[model samples]
Target chain A: MIEPFTVLSSRTVVLPVDNIDTDQIIPARFLTTTQRDGLGRHLFADWRRDAANRPREDFVLNRPGAEGARILVAGRNFGCGSSREHAPWALLDYGFRAVISTEIADIFRSNALRNGLLPVVIDADSHAWLLAHPGAEIGIDLRDCTVRMAAGREAGFEVEPFARHCLLNGIDPLGWLLSQVPAIQAYEDRAACRA
Target chain B: MTAPRTLFRKVWDRHVVVPETAATPAVLYIDLHLVHEVTSPQAFAALRERGLKVRRPDRTLATVDHSVPTAEASWASGLGEMDHAARYQVRTLGENCGRSGVRLFGVNSARRGIVHVIGPEQGATQPGMTIVCGDSHTTTHGAFGALAFGIGTTEVGHVLATQCLLQRLPRTLLVELEGRLGPGVTAKDVILGVIGRIGVDGGTGHVIEFRGEAVSAMSMEERMTLCNMAIEAGARAGMVAPDETTFEYLAGRPMAPQGEAWERAVVEWRELNSDPGAEYDRSVTIDVGALEPQVTWGTDPGMVMPVSGRIPAPAGAGHRKALDYMGLSAGAAIAGQPVQVVFIGSCTNSRLSDLRAAAAVLRGRRVAPGVRAMIVPGSQQVRAAAEAEGLDRVFRDAGAEWHQSGCSLCIAMNGDRAAAGQYVVSTSNRNFEGRQGQGARTLLASPLTAAASAITGKVADPRPLLEEGRRIA
Candidate 1:
């Protein structure tokens, strides 16, 4: 369901680490299953591992404060490697609606939005500010592409007009293509005639 | 304003099957289809699902790479019962191609090498042809003056179903290089310099045509290395107009037609250059003589500077964040960053040429202790060729692991990965965060730098190690 009004949850899980790759987001072991269910339990499956290769409780995501986090506050260049759609798929499946980072990888940024996850860029000071105010909530209005954080702090970020429009309309690129069925049909007819 | 004759316009006009309109996608005529292990599975699956055949299957060539277990799994016994991701992908490629009557150059096949390397070596890549692959580094094929681009699975399906697809014409930029490169500076430095000047997104929607005196003088392999990283600057594709060098490289390959056909092909290829009055949307120029060997300090291809230059202080939010996360400080020379691992293999640089370059460095040197070094050949054919020349033995004797061919450290989609916080000097295309593995730091460089780093156990210039005997065979 597309919610008319959305707010970034205050319960943020900070991964203040750089170069968090797609495989680490969802390990290859969990990828064998085709479906999207129960992926949340396996998020950060490899990094959260103990010396015995079991889930490490000391990992941030396993901590009580970060359980069921919907907004992931990550370090710089988050989602930098791989073109696997599974990375965003797993992140979305695990209930993360927004990812706040200093820099997002080029493909990963586009992939996240297409998969219905929002990627936000905040300056280092803002990032530190958010980390300091752990329970600070930010209200994200997709229509305006603006984030309103606690204590009256607000920032204007940009999303591609097409992507913003698509997210608001709950239309994937393929779905957007289908919406232009009339134009597509006409083009096909003209192409056939030319042939 | 004088009418700008852009590289994109010239190439686009040459290949345009139908005129452009707001409603219709540009009808691009494809000349070759190069496939590899990582991206072909889904395309083949789409073909099977549609109950369609690969249109112009002869134009389509397949080679195995990516997901190759180049380490311990180089032997078949090592792959037993592992159900490794690459093993499945390799098997799928073989089975799918066999069923479809498309050629699958398997690891067992002598011709199998990195797709880009094998394509050019066999002369499948030629001028004025459009090439597409599922993998991004397909730009490597552009060195032959063919338009090339990476496509998604759906686009792959579209190509498989019809042997053609609708595409938007890209804006063209003429990136002119001036002056001779300094000694120790190579083609890698040239492209890395271009990327540094033009940020990653600078070429976002354009096709880059490299020109000028310096570029025209490069060898085919060097040209491929430059074009391969076009995607790094966010270009749709890149091309170098075909010339004598291009013609020479294709002369004896098996796929290239001989006799009158070869003559005719060359005649046609000579016309692939941009017309004098062609128009371009934009242009950028670089003076290569001033550039030094480059190394990346931050998480992006754009976050690179000359090895002699210090890491820049974070300027934008993105830059600051990238530096902080990489645990780097401003003004620190990138040359001496202690590398935890060194990887030299990928579609970008895993050819016989790349191997020869690395081998020249590894000939008498020992890898620094506590530093893991691996050299995965781009293809099985490349592996054999290296072994034939004792390059593999050189690597092994120098304390580096000689691996079977595959896209080993490029994306690490298979089991091969670096542990968290591990810093890797890699020859792969992108050094984006976690590209090698989760929390794994990647420093992008040419194979020479990767091998040199492997030997010295830190980021070091490869020039000294390679000066005497490392002319690319």
Candidate 2:
């Protein structure tokens, strides 16, 4: 049910804060429905709104020229806490095609990739450059696995080749795994016989 | 010949459905798959959309936890005062489980509890198994020597369709704790001390094996508590070798093997320890005797200090921000800091033993006048056991509310929250901003420390209070 992703060029929203956990991305209270569509409205709900339901002027998403940004440039250890897939759901629902960070939590990175949200890990210099220029256009070439800043500075990153193949083909791993059922059953049978 | 194996390698290698090749990660077969309401709804929907049946429904278990109310009235009335959206998720879980033919412990079920607590209590967690849940706290099951970790919703759907996960191998780290723990110090303190020493991200991309004398001396519940916080330390999973203590705990549980099967399981479990010549990618040791009752002073679990210690000076911008948010001054003592609430419950420390420990401190005492203290048992079974022993009476007489089981106040997903700016001493893990409630300050501690703080309305140590009671007796 995911769209195949290959190349994306979009302006980046800068959020230069480390350890921005999944809870911050999408608070637990907002994780009410199974449907992933409406979650974009609640993304960063706590940080975006005051207790009185007024929008916070200083929050990055509320600032001017922050709309329609498809790439998020964040700090280190992004999406660090909780195994809530709601975090990535909110990000993708909000139109973020990719997130660039110096580091991403292991679980979050896996979740993002499986959901067709590209998690781009760049060097400190590239991260700093993106953060320094808010609303700057950045290009991600999934075919080549490279990230390019608007100034033509580029960084090559690594994504698991299999995950890349799945994303490029828009294939759900379950189908592939289902095809390997015979092999799985064989392994189980062999292990049981040994036992 | 293969190298000698650490506990992690031994268990991980046993679960490999397909070995890692040039193009794909290894396909690891899961022995148990725990599902909760919060993360499983989408996964079930995904299955429905694809017209796929749950491949191994027998291996999967479901429960409603995060969105369930802990109040007895809510259970009595079916959905009393519960929000519409929250009730929808729980109801959907029941419907999904019914359609998928997977067993679910509904809100009113006697077996209902936090998924992690129910797994061990029912003996679903076993040695040398691969367990997956859509919850990070699934690491708590690793205490049984299972290679358990949380996965995302998509992976949850994949596991439901095929009882296998594609995972790359993780490095192993051996965390050894030598010497005996001092009186009043609990597993929570030890883990807090470990996280403080290692920092939050120190265990990234690794599986940690907790070994040595202190870990060996811990009870099954204590071991679970230690492994539960491994995620807080950034480890993918944490495990303790299954010993006689582990077997003893699993022996009579409902799902545990019996008779000949039980005997065979024990024989295999006994061999689960790390080989003598095994090598860990990293190893560190801590002297348990040197630990004290520890508490978090800031927003994260890593910003911890001993109860007897002073607040540390800010070391960086993060530390300064944490201090400012906590409303604490550097160099000031944490002992007399005022607390408005004390919560004793969570998958981390909500077992029968945890309740008994807190009850011991609350007996013949009353909660301090302005503090709202509550004890939510980990499960329905734990609640029944506590009431049989009159532990609930002790908590009630001491002015603490005794509530039914669920993850209450830990993540505050079910309308259970502390007031903004209020300082709370909680027995649950995670002190992240607004984890307890929006703008609330949480100090993570053990049940004993939380009970003591409830009585004094401040951060107080339980050792002196316990010893004083002994002297009076």
Q: Which one is best on lDDT?
A: 2
- State the lDDT of candidate 1 residue by residue for B82-184, as single tens digits: 4465677778888877887777788677787778778887788877778887666788888988888776455565666666655666678889999898776
TM-score between model 1 and native: 0.77
Report the poorest 10 consecutive residues by lDDT, candidate 1 chain B: B2-11
Tell how far residue B461 is off in model 2, in angstroms: 1.8
Question: What tens digits encode model 1's per-residue C-alpha lDDT throughout A1-195?
Answer: 233224454467777765566656875545443233467766777667753567778778767877666888887667644445557767877788988887776556766765678988877777877667654566777777676777788777766666666677775444333344454445445645633
Per-residue CA lDDT of candidate 2, range A31-134, in tens?
88878777888888878997778999999999988899999999888888799999999999888989999888889999999989999998898788888999
State the lDDT of candidate 2 residue by residue for B150-231, as single tens digits. Answer: 9999899989988889988999889999999988899999999999998777687899999999999999999999999998
Model 2 pairs in collision? none
Model 2 has a DockQ score of 0.69
Write down the TM-score of every candidate.
0.77, 0.97
Indicate the residue-level lDDT of A21 in model 1.
60
Badly placed stretches (over 4 Å) of model 2 are A191-195, B76-78
